[model samples]
Target: MRVLVAEDEQDLADLVATGLRRHAMAVDVVYDGTAASERLAVHDYDVLVLDRDLPGVHGDQICQDLVGVGARTRILMLTAAASVPERVAGLGLGADDYLPKPFDYSELVARVQALGRRSQAPVPPTLRRHGIVMDTQRLQVTRDGRFLRLSLKEYAVLEVLMRADGAVVSAERLLESAWDEHTDPFTTVVRVIISRLRAKLGDPPCVHTVPGAGYVL
Candidate 1:
């Protein structure tokens, strides 16, 4: 999944981006709300990790703007304020979830994944196709009761395809939805990842190449 991280602290932003990337998610880090808004406008993100305090634009306004513009990206607000009223205010501004400062990285990851799952179009948590079972929450994949080991990127690609089920997803769509904003659109990263996933999945003709289009699972 692709995520936009809007945080003022450079070090913290980098750390969050690195951790999300390690989980096979494409993440773009922006230091302030202006850059965050621009990034949100230009790219499709599964989730937005926004800090409440920001230069140019506060995170609340950012969330409100996104909702007003009908952007489907889920918002997870991060703030130093931990009061109940503060959390309620963030949620009222259109944030889907909220995380206070000095939070656990694992919890952040979990929340992001939960937001992603929530953003999906009303699909069950367990996505199954062609004998492959993917547990979105557990981040586990199994084929016919056998566990399948996948790298982060591979797993992400499969997840996207599985979510689409029998529908064809173009490469450009995949790049937009599954890759970080900073990733070059012209690159063959999606193709490479799909190839690796096909190899790992043992080629049951599940992921079909659509010639001039993209792939379907």
Candidate 2:
């Protein structure tokens, strides 16, 4: 999963990113709300960890803008203000969850996971197809009861395809959903990952390339 973290505190941002990365989640950290808004507009992230006070734009405004634009990324607002009214305001502005400053890192991680689970597009928590089973919570993929070793990007690609099931997912859609903003779509990165996945999946070819279209599983 990918998460975008926007915080004015350099140390806190790095700390949060590092902790999430340890759990195999890809993270992008930005120091201001303007950059946060820009990143949100271009990339697809499972969750947005936003600080309420930020440079250029307030986090609440950014969250509101994202919701107004119909962005589905779940928002977890962080602020020093711990009042009930403050939390309510954040939620009213489209944040899915709110955490005050000096909170526990474990709580933050749990909240992020909960928001991601809630934001998913009505798919079951665990997805299974073509003898392949994916456990989103465990971040594990298994085929025919055997584990499959995959790189982070490869796992991300397979997760996207599996979530879509038999639907034909376009290249642009996969790029937007699976890759960060820095990844170049023109490059054969997705193709390479798909090739590796196909080799690992073996005989039945769980992922099928549709000429002039995209891929389906």
* lDDT values for all models: 0.88, 0.85
Which pairs of residues have clashing backbones in candidate 2? none
In terms of lDDT, model 2 sits at 0.85
The lDDT of model 1 is: 0.88
lDDT of 2 at 129: 95
| lDDT, candidate 1, 16-134, per-residue tens | 99998887788999999999988888888889999999888888889999999988899999889889999998899889999999999999999998898777688898898999999
Q: Alpha carbon lDDT of residue 171, candidate 1?
A: 93
- Tens digits of per-residue lDDT, candidate 2, 1-217, equal 6799999999999999888766556688999989998888777888999999999888879998989988878999988978999889888998888999889998998889788777777778789999999887777889998898877677788888887879998888777766666678798887888999999877777799999889999
Give the TM-score (vs. native) of candidate 2: 0.89
Worst 10 residues of 1 by lDDT: 198-207
TM-scores for all predictions:
0.93, 0.89
Which is the leading candidate under lDDT? 1
Worst 10 residues of 2 by lDDT: 173-182
